[model samples]
Target: MSQNQSRVTEFILVGFPGLHREYYGLVSFVLFLVYAITVIANATVFFLFVTNRSLHKPMYYIILNVSVCDFLFSTTTLPKIISRYWFQSGSISFIGCFVQMCFVHYLGSVNSFIFSLMAFDRYCAICHPLRYITVLKSSTVHILSVTAWSIAIIVPLILAIRAYPLPYCASNIINHCYYDHIGITLLACTDRTLYSFPAFTSAMIILLLPLSFIVFSYCAILIAVSKVADSKNCVKSLSTCSTQLIIISLYYVPRCFVYLTSHVGIQFSTDVRVVIIMLYSLGPPMVNPLIYCLRTKDIRECLVKQFCISTGHPKAQVSVVTN
Candidate 1:
């Protein structure tokens, strides 16, 4: 490639043009608050898992890692978005775009992988309770974590590198908040099929395939739990699985909507785009810790005890994570 045909130096972002004129201040403020809360929430979850022995189990381990990924994933775009939305500068360097895409893809993949693992963990716990510890040993967990992260990083790196090989003489206006393929494709003189192929594959692996696994595994788990003669055990299992199912749906619905709309050639308004992106990126991180606190008795009890100890309440107060 000639010097002019090299990777873009900078691209102008056109984040929600319609929303930009109306309610810019309101949207920016709301996004800022969501970003801040997501960081704090995920960080707290990771910290809790690290400090609390009661939470040092396989399930919490996956949750802690998921929180870490969510924290990184949200940070990849929100800060720049806050700057652009509030300060009227929506430009990102080509290198910056690549880095943004890398981290976003990596963390998203890691989050998906962790979700799959969590499903399997629940399966083992419910179906083969006696062998849970042996099945998810420390060595196996470490290997799985490393493998997930490696694949997430490696695939994105290859795609980003390959995408820069062609010319980029088209308009440098990125029509999205971040380094999404649709925005970048508009900048390419070529067909942009190279970028699309990898992204399509990655999406299938990260979202659809894992979702299939989660749904199937949970279904099996529910069936297995129903086989127990004890009503108390059945109720307990149903409650726990229901919580997981709810969280999975919350995490997935926005993404599925975006993907389906894009595939169906449905054009989203700038305001709609902004709203959907924020919902997809921010909701999971903020909701995860709340889910754990509300769903698990031990975590809630521990928090209550800790609260009582600090506040000198003489007794623990029950608290729930409200929506």
Candidate 2:
């Protein structure tokens, strides 16, 4: 409860130091392109789910959640960065910084939870085919979705509340692309360890716990598939899990490296850090919908129908998402 415990009025976000102002226009364009793709790709899946009743199944519902989270996740961080580059405005109000930090972390946690839930659903569908319907009933899906959203929202709230009263009597400059929890917290005049350790620990728990669950769920799945009577069906089922694994890998593998780089005292240049963050954060959302359309026949068919109608080529089964 010192002077540094007072809330800040605003924080200046210093985007990539290596990215010179001369290249701001280039960076802005790139950020805008990535944001547009992220939004459009996820929005396509969301639109299809909302308008088409055929996609109302349990698996599709999980996908819908993924799309929603992706869209929100991109929204929470990208626009501010875009504005920073486009308009040369990197100053975010204290509350606005908190809002961005909260949503970025919360939506990320929600996505992690949803991925685990999706793994669990797949495990049930493939391993307990007979009980799949009973196990993942509509009501159960609703409860799980609500639980995921609630947990995600609460975890960040606790962290924000803890840091809310911290005095920011020092330079209110965040040396990052956007208003991130650690970046914002680093600006405070208090002992950095006081907030950093807890933030780091909670992040690890949020990340590792669900990841462990996902691995276990998939292990259970592989074992179950190995015991199946028909080899072809077993392969088919494994393929499904493999596709999902690709999505999981795309989302998580970079994070593992980033954590390693930070922990082992490996130095990444400002531009390198920014690029790394953009890849993991924006890459998965941009690619996930395309994965669904290409890897699954049902989703592919649905998208084709939508494409043909929109282009007025009703006879052709086109994959417009690719284009």
Candidate 3:
């Protein structure tokens, strides 16, 4: 192959294959609305957490971190996609694609880890209420928070670096929504499997580690809750956990399907597969804030109190345990 042919300077993301030109307008409009809602919803949670002094506890801090991750996760991929569908512009510079791919994967991995930390916090809070304060002190939260961000960013950086020197001689058209490792690696003129498989396996490992941790912690939580003599206490414990469990499943289940489909000979049309991918990446951030607000008492209290006080209403208390 000629040297010039091997040098790839940019890539074209074909937003969602099979949609063609007819539906771009509608798709763009919907994406814009979803993007707006995602930002607004998570930002409100993050802002509330920051502004409210009563929310300085460990669990709320975890939610605050998750909120920030949710905002960034959507921000990384949505704007690029919105512009692609809106303007018929899908071209992204090589460096720009690298940055996007890094953050998309980075924030994803971070969210998984963050969820695991939350599971740990819940376990301590419920199973060992006395030690909970000591286990998740402000210092510990800061360390764990920094660790999640650092590892998430570093691992994806290594993956991106691995793809850095690869030559894209064939074509630069990415067949999915945003600049993901799989889509970008597929365009490389070299052995696509050679480049793709290792990265795929690494990602699976990163995903599974947290998933395993979450499972074990939640199981332990179940055991602890079961031993409680009061049935009401047991139910309350399980109820608090149910929302986190739902959020965890939302984040990981579709991802497992997408990953397993490749190796198991499952067939999905390009559009269907892309739709699944969109849900995997976008669903958690959209649903997490709602689940927390609707399920958790303290955060709703924080939200209501913050809104009311900010609007000049008298101080008030709010508490409703959702069943």
Show where candidate 1 strays beyond 4 Å: 1-8, 265-267, 317-323
Write one digit per residue (lDDT tens) for candidate 1, span 36-80. Answer: 888887776766666669877777777777777878877887888
Q: Report residue 66 deviation for candidate 3 (angstroms).
A: 1.1
Candidate topping lDDT: 3
- Runs in model 2 deviating more than 4 A are 1-8, 317-323
Q: In model 2, what are the clashing residue pairs, if there are any?
A: 4-167, 5-166, 5-167, 6-167
Off by over 4 Å in 3: 5-7, 310-323
By TM-score, is 2 or 3 better?
3
lDDT of 2 by residue, 1-323 (tens): 36454545788887886778899999889989988998888888888888788888888888889889998888888888889999999998888888888888899899999999889889999988899999998679889999999978887998888877778887887778877788877777778887888889988889889899999999999888888899999899998787678888887789878987899999988778877887898888888988988997668778888888887984474444344
What's the CA RMSD for each of the models? 3.3, 3.0, 2.4
TM-scores for all candidates?
0.90, 0.93, 0.94
Instruction: Arrange candidates by TM-score, descending.
Output: 3, 2, 1
Give the Cα lDDT of each candidate: 0.75, 0.85, 0.86
Better structure of 2 and 3 per lDDT: 3
